[model samples]
Target: MANFSTNEFKAGLKIMLDGEPCNILENEYVKPGKGQAFNRVKIRKLISGKVLEKTFKSGDTFEGADVLDTTLAYLYNDGEFWHFMNNETFEQIAADAKAVGENVKWLVENDDCTITLWNGNPISVTPPNFVELEITETDPGLKGDTAGTGGKPATLTTGAVVRVPLFVQIGEVIKVDTRTGDYVSRVQK
Candidate 1:
């Protein structure tokens, strides 16, 4: 319903393009010595997760998209859908496997997650930046290897595998960076 001029284009801005909601990933302006200037925008489609680039004249505009981000506590997956609830309102929503994507591996019961909604429906789910999950399987820890000089692959409780220090062992809880899937440190207790 709202219009956004090219001047307002910036990373993270959401607007409608070709009848679909798209989030602006990058916006670059170009001006020539002899002609008019234009803007190049890189955007990602909300529903399909596709990225594309478009160019617009300096004064062009686009319709604003109805996008919102909210924090919700994850409930559980019913094989077909993953559920989440708003702690304050107790409102619940379900996201299909497409919406969950690869983030399903980082979800843990009762954990808070960032959910992106478009037109009152979820389009994407983001897990916490860092999570502490127990190592369900891995090779036995090497004796006197507390320094973590060498690393080994560890399977987390959520089924995601990551390389951890040699000192890490199965059944130990460790903090991991969800964004990079890197081992951060061991969780005390």
Candidate 2:
């Protein structure tokens, strides 16, 4: 356990409050020009996914949670457990699908991801910000539609659909923005 002042709050920094794990989502140092400096923090509960706003004086200290992050390679799912192996140690840990949530969509075999460990147990998995996937299905691009002003829906090999430009064609590889699930641009083959 460690102590952090309110001014040190940052996103993804886990802190304990009322015997529960909470992470700082966003923190802003505010001073009303007449009052003492304070930190306005938007915190999210790790287990319940609840978000709350709290204020603390700049000099206040809080108990920070002991969280460990390790790079893990994603392995295949065994119907119940999603397995991952630490790249450095080759140690395996299996987490349930519910624990992985929508992040499972971005999991490609052998892909490396950061696993957040709380009390030596996997609590969350964060995938890469971007991934390249081949377009499996999409209508043929309109002939002579070089305007590139509109987009059409296309399905990727992962079964995730995204809007690609009208120039995109089936069997073409494209870069996908995992954060927004939107097509960035078609990859040059």
Candidate 3:
């Protein structure tokens, strides 16, 4: 168990607090003209996804959390839990909806995903920033109409619906940004 001082607090730092692992989302130092300095930290709980703010003295220390992220191949979803497999060891890991969060819409079979493990258990799952998905359903595109100033809604193969350019067709594969659920570009070939 390593200790982290207030000066070491930064975004993406994981530390143990109140017997749970929490990720530091934001850390800001505040010094008053008359009083002592403190660090304001915004942290999100690992397991439950709850977020809170805590203040620590300038010299306060916190234990480092045993958090690690590993790349895993996504297998499939069982309606209740999403399953992922480690390619090297053939070990499978299951994560519930909470852990998957909005990333579930970006998962396709065989896609590589980053799984955050805390104390040997998966605490979060992050899909690739960009995903290529084939459009399963969408309105037909008009002839000689290639501009996408006015896009149409499209349902992807993964059951996630997103707006695509008017030139996009149901059979065409397009790249989508998972973070914002926006269409990036059409996949060539």
* The best candidate in terms of TM-score: 1
Top of the candidates by lDDT: 1
Give all TM-scores, in the order shown: 0.93, 0.80, 0.88
Clashing pairs in 1: none
- Model 2: pairs clashing at backbone N, Cα or C within 3 Å: none
How well is each residue in 1-189 modelled by candidate 2, as lDDT tens digits? 889888688898899987767889999989989989988999987656689999888889999987777888888889898899987888999987656877777777788887877788877788777887888999998766763577889988878888887878999998888888878877888
> Each candidate: what lDDT?
0.92, 0.83, 0.90
Per-residue lDDT of candidate 3, residues 32-146 (tens digit): 9999999999999887789999999899999999999999999999999999999999999998888898778899889999999987888799899899999999999775676
Supply candidate 2's per-residue lDDT for 78: 90
- Provide the lDDT at 118 for model 3: 86
Better of 1 and 2 by TM-score: 1
- Those runs of model 2 whose alpha carbons end farther than 4 Å from true positions after fitting are 7-12, 29-38, 47-51, 57-60
